[model samples]
Target: MEKLCPRFEKAMGLISTRWVGLILFDLLKGTKRFSEMEADLPISGRLLSDRLKMLEKEGIVKRNIYSEFPVRIEYSLSDKGNELEPVIKAIQFWADEHIPPEETDDTDEQRV
Candidate 1:
């Protein structure tokens, strides 16, 4: 069998990181503020912040800061990140088919 390429390995490393796939999946809905994501996902604010920073650095996510009294910040997928939509959808489909409800936690059901 052919060895996995470095690019594939790197991509897996990023997406397989805890919460990274979920973060990307959530952003697929639309751009969201940090607090919005915090509320949407079970992740803590600090860990979410860290993952956002990492994704931003990887060019998978974009961070926009609005110049306002409160300095609002929002996150959206970069073009590259948007390209993963089909992949994310496939995963969701697979889970729905193969992963029984009883095997998944309550939170997992609500996320879909």
Candidate 2:
């Protein structure tokens, strides 16, 4: 098929955003709560929540509730999500080696 199916579009759309790479990279580090993710990512609350929800729906992220008093929730990568690690790392490695400073508007905050 020439055109992308809605499911394909939806699935690819989940991790094909600006800050998604960073989000997934961080989630791979460990399970993190909503606030922790927000604090680590540069996107706004709405965008982060949207990304998290999309990933969860796509089976790339699994959310858990650990506390009720403060309503604590944590997000981690699912099995499928863990499967993306190598791809992400490969791409990141390529970018780290080739992409230079003054590139796109990605707020990596570190010089290669």
What lDDT score is found at residue 98 in candidate 2?
84
Question: In candidate 1, what residue range of length 10 has the lowest lDDT sum?
Answer: 103-112
lDDT of 2 at 70: 81
Query: Which runs in model 1 stand beyond 4 Å of their true positions?
Result: 107-110
Model 2 stretches with alpha carbons more than 4 Å out: 1-12, 104-112
**Candidate 2 worst ten-residue window by lDDT:** 103-112
The 0-to-1 C-alpha lDDT of every candidate, in the order given, reads: 0.92, 0.82
CA lDDT for candidate 1? 0.92
Residue 25, model 1: Cα distance from true site in angstroms? 1.1
| Total clashing pairs for each candidate | 0, 0
lDDT of 2 by residue, 1-112 (tens): 4998988797567667777888889888989989998888777899889888878887999999876888889999999999989988887899888887567665554221
lDDT of 1 by residue, 1-112 (tens): 9999999999999999999988999999999999899998988899999999999999999999999988999999999999999999999999999998788787642456
Cα lDDT for residue 58, model 2? 78
